[model samples]
Target: MEVTYLCPHCIGAINALDNIILSAKTEKNKHGLILLHEEIWNYSVIQTSSINAELGEIVDFFCPVCHASLNTEKGDHYAGYIRMDASGQESKIVISREYGDRRTFKITGEDIESYGESARKYMYPEWFL
Candidate 1:
């Protein structure tokens, strides 16, 4: 059986199951990463190494406010409210969180569902690096 892998630019791991979705952390400072039905959110900064993840898995990072460690369970998708441009656009956007440069990278919906039906489920995001 041949194991398919994700695009190096997008996911880690040299080989991942074809039916298995993958996510690579682009950012470093990710306090929290959540995967909801249609959106992905990152709470704070997370300083660590490259992230290589699979579906139905938990990625442990950190907490922005309390600076405590946190765990985020990945689902098919997830979402949260976000304020845009400080204008209070208050948009409910779909996205994925990738930590880098002490900032969280908000990925577009296309990026979240890039893996198709094999979307990875985030879980127990307390391990950083």
Candidate 2:
């Protein structure tokens, strides 16, 4: 089943061709497009040649459609959006904003499903939801 990701603000679909496209800006003020693998936990990423993002570097993620920042209200350490499965089940998807910090969370109601090795850093994932 294919899952579609949407910007939390504009509710615009963000995934295309199995990649979640997001506008990104690094701390160095470099801007570019970031393509993240749509499958949760995959962690495959591709950045435009214009950007030079180092591993473990944190970058700002934004909705490519509305240009609204996707940074979670919880903290800059994560970015969040909405995810809908093929059956139309929707939930909140939060991911580590820092490059190479493999943490992802799927929040549905009071339930929190954590994935990736770095997810262990957050012992209680429900607080963010």
Candidate 3:
């Protein structure tokens, strides 16, 4: 199954692989000032240089297109939402601390129960077992 990430703000595609998001990290430039550097899969590292080697703390992942915070809640350690589509089946998998650390799988189009099961199996195998 293929996955795609969309910017919640602009609804723009962010990465190519649709798996594993490399968030921006702060680094110091030659002037010793902090700057945000992001590296996307199959894409060149943004603002990476010899002088900017010190990796700083990353608060949250942002939408590369609109620069919107991906996390649904403030101060969430890690959050992710998955949009799945197969054989005319559409579903959304949202996992976030704001939702009480639960995985919400919403399926639409056809076979709601069956599609939800399949999505859960493909997305989180451990949940089934």
Candidate 4:
């Protein structure tokens, strides 16, 4: 089954090949394109050499199309977008912005599922709805 990632702001397709691509900027002002595995639980990253993201460093993410900042408005150290599954059901996907923090959340209405190294039950994020 395939899943499509979309920019919450622009609703533009953000996934290509087997990766989800986003524009990112490190706290130190280094910018690059970030490629993350389309598989939600995979933490592997492919980014330009300019982005030397250190552990716990916040890397700001933006939609490649509309350039909308993906950061969650609550400043909870996460960035988010929409994920549409093959069946056309949509969910909100949120991931930690801190480099090396493998925290991810998939929120479908009131159901919140988590994945990655730091997976945990999460509160339903009304802002992402």
Candidate 5:
């Protein structure tokens, strides 16, 4: 039977439970909540975008399960750098993707720092202006 769950983000009702017959021969269900969290993260990624990285490549983002905002420390092989400005919180990462003729991306540490400050200033104009 498919069980229903109330999604925390959408605030909507959804099915969550699944029927599974466990054999008595099995010792234990070794996995627990952490595994569940990992699954949740994967689910979020699938639900959010159609674009995806290639095999062996991962575009790491915030931990969707924990809802703790994440910052990218370094870019990937495809993109040089990425920066995010959300709710006055600044985050940055260097990423790469195959976009038309552009194959690689890179950003300097100084540029990242400058971008962070610029984001902060944009959010609070009185402080910088």
Candidate 6:
């Protein structure tokens, strides 16, 4: 299956991959201070990177096109929507989380019954049903 990461604010495509999105972190020096750096990797190329104020700090994702934050006032974690297309099926998936761990998923599309079901089966939150 193919997955596409988008800017929920501007509905701009961030990265499209044949596989799932991957993330990694490393410490880097910035402005003479060492900071925790995290990056989103797409096909082994760094797509986006950010420096955190401290370790385990939750950084917000921004739209590359409009520079709008992907998270809302609800929490410090990611709470954005993503567009997925597979086998001629197109759908928008809403990803929401309170913080730390809990997350909610909502799917909408012309064929939500089948596309959403497929997403629930392949992705996390099997309770999406």
lDDT of each: 0.28, 0.89, 0.36, 0.88, 0.24, 0.38
> What overall lDDT, based on C-alpha atoms, would model 5 receive against the true structure?
0.24
Superposed model 3: Cα runs more than 4 Å off:
18-22, 25-59, 74-76, 88-90, 93-129
Best by TM-score, which number?
2
| Distance from true location, Cα of 16 in model 6, Å | 4.2
Candidate 6 residue spans exceeding 4 A from truth: 16-55, 88-129
Model 4 agreement with the true structure over 21-115: per-residue lDDT tens digits: 99999999999898999899899998888886788899999999999999988847899999999999999899989888888888998888888
Superposition error at 66 for model 6 (Å): 1.8
Clashing pairs in 6: none
RMSD value for candidate 1: 15.5
TM-score order, best first, reads: 2, 4, 6, 3, 1, 5
TM-score, one value per model: 0.24, 0.94, 0.39, 0.91, 0.18, 0.42
Please identify model 4 stretches exceeding 4 Å from their true place: 121-129
lDDT of 2 by residue, 1-129 (tens): 789999989999999999999999988889999998998879888999887788888889999999999998776588989999999988988888898888999888888989899889778655676
Error of 6 at 45 (Å): 11
Of the candidates numbered 1 and 4, which has the greater lDDT value?
A: 4
lDDT of 6 at 77: 46
- CA lDDT, candidate 1, residue 107: 32
Residue by residue across 14-123, what tens digits does model 6's lDDT show? 65333223232223332111111111111122223343334443444445567665555543343454655555443444333221222334345333332222234444
The candidate 3 region of ten consecutive residues with least summed lDDT is 32-41
For each of the candidates, the C-alpha root-mean-square deviation to the true structure, in angstroms, is 15.5, 1.2, 10.3, 1.9, 17.3, 8.9
lDDT of model 2 at residue 37? 92
- Please report, as a residue range, the 10-residue window in candidate 5 with the lowest summed lDDT: 18-27
Candidate 5 structure quality by residue, lDDT tens digits, 1-129: 222222233323322232111111101212112101112112121221233233343332222233322223333222221222223332222222211211211122333322222234322212111
Top model by lDDT, which number?
2
lDDT of 1 by residue, 13-105 (tens): 222222222222323322223322221232322222344334333244332223332223343223222213224322222223321211122
